[model samples]
Target: MRMVFRWYGEGNDTVTLRQIKQIPGVEGIVWALHDVPAGEEWPMDKIAAYKELADTYGLHLEVVESVNVHEDIKLGLPTRERYIDNYKKTIEKLASVGVKVVCYNFMPVFDWVRTDMHKELADGSTALFLEKAKIEAMDPRELVRAIAGNPDFTMPGWEPERLARLSELFDAYREVTEDDLRDNLRYFLEQIIPTAERCGIRMAIHPDDPPYSVFGLPRVVKHAADLRAILGFADSTANGITLCSGSLGVRQGNDIPAMAREFAGRIPFAHLRNVRVYENGDFIETSHRAEDGTVDMCGIVQALHETGFGGYARPDHGRHIWEEQCRPGYGLYDRALGIMYLWGIWDSLGRGKQTKREAFSV
Candidate 1:
């Protein structure tokens, strides 16, 4: 597994590239042009500039977290063709700078949903938490105020410009269903996978956060069958999925390790993090250690190793540790710690395989 770190950019993030360079085993940055609006082509000069900056820190610019799919595309509006064309252009531009995987999601309105950004844990370190009851009871506009209200950092999915039309977007998605969303995604993959294949870049779709319907919005990429159906949309390796542990782990049904082994060849990116689920259906992000959360971190890594996964993975989210006043889940301290834990599991698995091979040889 090739480990990478997600860096927002120069001024937009509190964590610096210098700090990211100090993290052992991290070889690249999972990045994107955050300032670029959805459905627009990314500026070529800005893409080159990002590559240049990462080069200064000895980090490869190979994986992009998202080139966000526009709501028009997800909604299957007539304007979607224009956005899809622009997405193809962005893929070619990213390919020019050596990007190997582009991670995007088809979740409508909100990309991911959480009730509390800093829900305090029993250990006093805070992490991103989702309260099911709260989510079901609260208005989405209230969520917008709670999440996007932060002036310090822009949340990935809750962009101010987009959520500004929350009511309208919600109305637009009201008529759309799960099957409709799947068809729209199929159309999108059909349009863009050819370009991605030509550019030697895999297009990875991130699973819906929480892997369930939220605020009555339809979620299509939520389970193993959903993943299988998505891969069937395009027969090329360029059509892929980002296996996010924390997102799918909240639901009790998803067997993450088995999914990893099953989707071995198709997954080009992974977001490996842990979340502790409660009897009440809420969850909180935890350290990457298996004991700390419900997700089988070690088992997932072992499966990846067994499958010989040569893809990019990142320590998805971290707790607010050491009183680090940073972005809700993008803090540096805990993420670095999470990286070490993941490495510990991966290296031990590697050593075990080597020992077994040596014993057989002897």
Candidate 2:
């Protein structure tokens, strides 16, 4: 596994490239042009600038967290064709700069939902938390205000421009169902996957944040069966999925390690993080250690190793520890710690396999 770190451009992120460079085993940054609006083609100059900056730090800019799919595309609006064309152009441009994987999602209205950005854990370190009951009871607009109100950093999915039309976006999706969303995604894949293949870039779709419909919005990429259907949509190496452990782990049913082993060849990107799930359906992000959360971190890494996964992986959504006061989930200390934990698991697995091979040979 090739480990990468997610850095939100120069000024946008509190964690600097210099700091990221200090993290052992991290060879690249998972990035995107955050200022670029959804559906618009990314500027080549800006893309080149990102590459240049990462070059100075000896980091590769191979994996892009997202070239966010526009709501028009997800809703199957007439204007989607224009956006799809723009997406194709973006892919070609990213390919020119040596990007191997482009991670995007098809979740409508919201990309990821959390009730609290800094829900305090028992250990005093805070992390992103989702209270299922709260989400069900609260108005989405109120939740939007809570998320977007933070002036310090822009949340990935809760962009101010997008949430400004929250009511309208909600109204637009009222008539759309899960099947309709799937068809729309299929159309999108049919249009773009070929371009991705030609560019030698795999288009990986991130699973829904909680692997469930939020605020009555239809979510197609949630479970293993959903993943199977999506891979069937375009039957190509370019068509892939980002196996996010924390996102799918909230639901006890998702066998994350099995999913990793099953979708081994198709997954070009992974977001490995842990989350503690409660009996009350609430969940909180935790350290990458398996004991700290419900997700089988070791098993997930073991499966990836067994599959000989050479794809890009990152420690996703770390806790806000040491009073870092950084992005809700994208803090430095915990993520770096998570990376070490992941490395420990991955290296041990490798050593174990080597020992077994030597014993068998003897």
Candidate 3:
């Protein structure tokens, strides 16, 4: 498992590349041109510029968190073809700069939903939390306001430009169903997989945040079966899944460790974070330690190690710690701590495997 950090470019992020370089075992950054809107082609010069920045920090630019799919592509609108062409061009541009995997999602209007960005935990450190009951009762507009309430920074998934037209987007998805979303995703894969294969880039789709339909919006990439179906859309290795633990772990019965082993070769990217699930179906992101959250993070890492995973992995959302004020979930302190935890598991597993081989040799 190659460790990477998620850095939102130069001025946009509070965490600097210098700080990221200090984190042990982190070799790369999962990044994107956040300023560019979906469906727009990324500028080639700008892509080269990003590479230059990473080079200065001695970090590899091997993975991109997202190249968001246009709503037209997800809704299967007639204009989708034009947007697809734009996507193909972007893929080629990214490939030109040595990007191996491109991580994206097909979730409609909202990407990840949370009731509170700084929900205080028992330990006094705050983290992103989701209360299903609150979502079911509150209006999406109110939810958007709450999520975007941190006016100082821009949330990756809940972009104000997109959420500003929430009512229209909701009306558009009203007639769309789960089956429709699946078909559209298949169509999207079919169009882009060929280009990705030729460019030597893997297209990994992130599972729906929470792994369930929100406010009647259809979610297709939720479970193991859904992952198999998505992989079946294109037989090539280029089509794949991101296999995010926190997103899929929100719901019970995901069997994250098993899924990690099952989809071994196909997963080119992973978002490793933990979320504690309550008996009442609520969840809150927590430390990456296995005991901290419901997700068995150590087991998941061991599975990846056994599979010989040679892909980019990053510590996903982390709690607000040490009073370090930054993006809601993208703070530095906790994520660096999470990296150390993952490394501990990985190195111990490696040593154990070596011991077994050495014992047999003697």
TM-score of each: 0.97, 0.97, 0.96
Identify the runs in model 1 with alpha carbons over 4 angstroms from their true place.
352-362
Can you give the lDDT of residue 43 in candidate 1? 96
The residue pairs found clashing in candidate 1 are none
Best by lDDT: 1
**Model 2 Cα lDDT, one tens digit per residue, 208-262:** 9988888888988889999999999999999999999999999879999999999
Q: What digit string (tens of lDDT, one per residue) describes model 1 on residues 1-362?
A: 88999999999999999999888889899998888999999999999999999999889999998999999999999999999999999999999999999999999999999999999998899999999999999999999999999999989988778998999999999999999999999999999999999999999999999899999999998999999999999999999999999998998899999999999999999999999999999999998889999999989998999999989999999999999999899999999999999988888877735432221211
Q: Model 3, 1-362: lDDT tens per residue?
A: 88899999988899999999888878899899898898899999999999999999889999998898989999999999999999999999999999999999999999889988899999999999999898988899999878787778878987777888899999999999999999999999999999999999999999999899889899998999999999999998899899899999988899888998999899999999999999988899999988989998988999998999988889999999999999999999999999999988988888835432221211
Worst 10 residues of 2 by lDDT: 353-362
- Relative to the true structure, how large is the alpha-carbon lDDT of every model? 0.94, 0.93, 0.91
Which pairs, if any, clash in model 3? none
RMSD of each: 3.8, 3.9, 3.8
